[model samples]
Target: MEWKTTSALSNQAIRTVGRIVEGSHDITIFSNTRAHPLSAQVAGIDIGRRTLTLRVFCPAGNIGDYLSDGLVSFDLEKINRDDPPLLLCFEKVQATCERIHSSLFEVRCTLADTLLITIKPGGVRVPFVLGMSASVSLDVYTGLTISARLCNLSVGGCMLEVPLEDSMPLTIHQQLPNIYIQFPNGEGLRSKGSIRNMRPFGRARHVAVGIRFIDLDRDMRQRLLYFITESEAELARRMGMENRRAGISPLFLVSPHDKKPANSNKRRNKLPPMAHAIKEVARQQHIILHCLKNERPFPEDMLYDSADTLLHLAESDRHQFLYALRYLSEEAAWVRHSVRVAALLGDVLPTQPGLVDDAREAVAGILLHAMGKPLLLSEHLPSLDTHLTASQRNLLKHHVEALRRQLHKVGWSPGPVLNRIVGDINERLDGSGYPAGKRAEALSELVRTASIIKIVDTLTHARNGRPALSPLDAYRWVYGNDGYDKKCLTRYVRRYGLYPVGSLVKYTGGFLAWVMELDREGSPRQVRVVKNLAFQDSKLDTVLADQDIQQIGKLEEVVDPANFQL
Candidate 1:
């Protein structure tokens, strides 16, 4: 087929195509006859070579015969439906093919003869020179939080303007733990980013740091696009009004606007009730950790507030809290673990007489108990399976002292109740624990309860190189141990069943599911089947009732939740 072609592609066109290819958009490959069109997806792109690698969905044997003439045609379509319609058609493009698997073929094609038309604008950076405040942490361990102003923003990344003093310690390509931007509505957006470039700003009074956002979720991307579209419309309207008032003919009569998707009005993606709670608690814990690492005094009231929130969540719906722990992001294991322990403590502590008054303080202490570990260990943080040298073990023990010093530096005291819980939570009944190494009587009831909760969480969750023990195994380990108080351990076991909520277990017939609820006897009552008997992920989350379990067979064993990304 004869086709129009461009000698060179513009930067905008290149960016648009890059996004489409990276997004893995489906494209149709056609030969001379449109009757036998082969469906394909863009797998990879080589910008320098101007070539595209496609995973074509066709019989491997048929692909060789289909591309025998070494020519194919396809179209690169726009990624967003909201964007103006745009299509870049490649006509009779030179091609080659190879078998990837049974029904998949790998096709490589060079865009030698291409027709580029109706190119949608991409990577349009809108200036946000207004007072858009942002906090960027250069390193998670160092806790170096730098204040910056939003200079310009786009869907991919943004440029921040920081004072020269604040930019002194930054390096190019340094991964930032988080970039928190406070929007006009007082909501904050947290993202992981890396420094791409740095240069002096106007007058050299400030530095312009370019950051590329990494792994932005769909919700974040939509928010950014909405902001950019609104800003562009505002700019156009302002310019048009200015020109009309000055009695000068407008350069362009019509203003540009985005045709947003129907659901674009929705601010954020709807997460499950439990997932939303877990996310909020995790976000708060992250901020608290950041403060502790930086040696800054966070709002003291926030501790009690968050503790109360956890307590309420645990009391009202302990099962949901337990199940939601699996949804936490994998960035900060310590923080996630702390939240789990604290929530568990909240659920278990209320049963003890006279302990309800101290439950809030106990939960707060559990949350911040390990806040100092990241400051000291940094990259050397040890896991349960890590074989630590004597010196490393001793260093790890000093994290308690480190936390005390940190609290003292901030001119805050957690009070006597919180102090005991934080300081002696690691101490065991048999004097085997570290720091103080208090014996049975020396460790208070509160300390004993929190300690059991912490150990149970540590053993049940996978970390570093260690495979997680089953809930029953973790409980057994603690119950069989000497340091734990039997009463507290029994309470814990009663609260969380042998196969607790969030436990990934394999039943008879090779079916894998997550324990969702338990009966009075702590036996699994409800489960959500994630994987079928063939070990393939189930398209639908099929929740099985107690009766359904009998037909599926007995509960075989608890598998590591990490393996299934539960």
Candidate 2:
């Protein structure tokens, strides 16, 4: 994304331009030295036989942060190395490759697409100095319509060089709400700001409105920052200004402080509930699904690399997990399942420091163990649950083996302990499991540990139009006369207590609570109330941030979503 400026040249001259010589008006030195647009400093410019070579450098030689991807052939019809044209425009050249050559100097009209700015009329451009015009639509809070221009462009919000008459009251500032900078195609850029300083040109019937971006929503902020850093370098290239100083410090938009309610103390006491967290998870999961559906990929590490992250998610820190989950899309269903599975396992695992690391890894593995579903489903329908039909079930039976094969393909060996876990996730100690009919004695600890994940997965979805198996019912089904290894079941109950963490359930009193931590009594005895189902008086009720569970009771009344207040 390098941009250079070309000087005024006549249509009938071919002169070889060279670097500026110090202290003398002498010109005849031929050097292809170029300057940076962010900070005008002479840099090595190599004009390749067929390409424009640009070499950007850091003062400390750390070129790691700079990247550009806007380069094309220099216009061939405009100029030639052997017969250089008199009038030429030297604009910033942007591309990934590292070459600029004499052969590429010819001017091509189509080259306008790669160039960021053009001084000529009707040319789309980025600012060289602190001035540029951005076409924008402004909606005044008073239902007034006005066309606004983003001028006086800087790293912060640009000045809305508005065409307002001096007769307009200066107090117009007080009535202004937040203004949105609409993009070219009517999409709003994240550059939302407020009027910071205003100077009215009454005689000219215009106002130089200074706007300071209060809350930049990521993308627009980055664009402004990039432009700021590149502006000075661009100026140097255009004027052939050789006297360069250190680059100007880039500016940033300051975000406004969020307004909080007057009763701050009560709000501080109310943490976001598990349901809120789960809602975030759902939202984030949908995002991931959307991204995948659009064929976009997120960082692989975010998908299934860390188990401690999952454990922390189940440990009353729903905010972090929810943030993480928003980056995932529904297409990454395996990753979604893995996160929930690991979160559930985190609840049941021993919290002892010595075993925590191992437990986290185990949970991570189980959640992602069936990650081959997407691939499997492409050739054969995916059966992620126990309720698949006979044909679908047969097709789904190959996932464990497929997972092992994929692991090997990627050259990852999580050690034999993990290997054993994957090998027996589908195994039942009663010799009725798929792919393996191993008996109780043959089932290793790793297998039993992996089996807990199966139990949780089964129990979580058992009632959502899939089936209605409670944790207790699930336990009985897995350990009863028709169940698998009783010893494994007993170990699970003893290890994780009765109700696992991350579990959402209702009590006898009709209150709903998510299992937070196992009570000393076991069986998910202690929980956090997510919503007060009985509190129907909106006047008495406050926002979630100003809520008080004690006003109702120790437990929450859980109702169907159709009947829930929120």
Candidate 3:
């Protein structure tokens, strides 16, 4: 859904977190004396006082240090997958200690006016602020050396702000053998690029020259993506904050059946606020992935703690948690895969409740099961196709080994149950899986869950590919005396029915709805209509046309999502 937000002070609806109060966010704290950045949280926000509380945290899930020093600088960004996050950099003008509690402190800092930046998804370039500078040097033209500010940065290219006073003058289509850009946070990018476009900026006697990167390596692309996600997410947070303060409706609102309709003017009890919830999850996932990508040790403390938080959630609030997982799947494709795999496992886990005590742990383990992929690929994203090339296959082959080494390197261990879930995720009972083709006899009972995941993974991959299979056909083929154990297959069908969540379906009435959940009798309990003959948001339309639409049994077939515009 498109979110429209504005600050109360401005007549213009500026979608920014300008002077937000009581908003929660994680931040990176860098000190002149400390070598590495410290992780922190915004404990309290007071817009009237022009200050925010920053509570420093240790990696071991405890607050070890607290400070109100003005010398510290913070580098923070919102990490959004679909939209670029807003990035902010600020220093403490003045700080005061308000109060202290166990592992929590209320320190306040006066902030400068927040600076908003738009970071492109996938490192693509949109317009950006021109405050950042970079060092430029030509490969062949050794005599050329110039420092220029940045106008914008995309994965493929970036525009440099050249001041008119600089002596360096180059013609159009100039080849820059090496361009090194160092962010204020010390994140740097070095790439070869060619001049694509150039123009003049007003009043500053500055010229904007655009350069397109020739071919970015895997690591560079991931870095750019992370940077962009961070920037966009921050802006989204600010927008949300401003709207709330102004007493406006939510910006990132979803239209669930229980909630009031978008078209209705009726008052309704507010659904649990979910925009920040998903962003928090995304931020946690991003942090862990960054650690893994940088060859840093696994952040077991953070990962385990995040999982525990989810595990301990009350049964009533589990719906919100599950909804957040669905939103995360839609936000980022990499995350989408993990959430789907995790959801599928979580759905069937309760069928045999004795197997696992906390289903959330299994869900968390499955969600992060693909961490090995990044450890093996080292920032290169894997394709969602079956026909991977030779090198890709080799990378998948040793992913298990890489995951083990990575965990050990991080100086932490996942406990026995979760370790089993994530450790042997790729290993199959029939010995067709990767990292170790151990037979079913030698595998643990937990290996059967891995087998269920294999089918989920296979069906989703093929359904999302060029040549697709209907969900029913895919289900029948994968479970029909296949590699999956008969017991697991029976449990899966009994719980989730023929169509799974994320499955696209066709109806005789010419409507398409995603299968959401199932009943005790294995019929579709809920579905959010995606398309219809009218082509508007179909949720309300479906409500009018069919109740428990799956029970009407007009399901012509389960179809590939690619065939229709969803």
TM-score of 2: 0.43
lDDT of 1 by residue, 20-102 (tens): 56642447664432123466777777766767788888743566544647886665543343432223345466788888778
Candidate that scores best on lDDT:
1
Work out the TM-score per prediction: 0.56, 0.43, 0.59
- What lDDT does candidate 2 reach at residue 147? 61
Q: For candidate 3, lDDT tens digit of each residue in 337-435?
A: 664566556555554657656566676776567666545532232332335566776767676677677667757677677777776666666777656
Against the true structure, whose TM-score is highest?
A: 3
| Per-candidate alpha-carbon RMSD to the true structure | 21.9, 19.7, 13.9
TM-score of 3: 0.59
Q: Candidate 2 regions off by >4 Å?
A: 1-305, 311-336, 344-361, 379-388, 463-465, 481-483, 494-501, 505-511, 515-518, 523-566
Worst 10 residues of 2 by lDDT: 26-35
Off by over 4 Å in 1: 1-270, 329-331, 377-393, 533-538
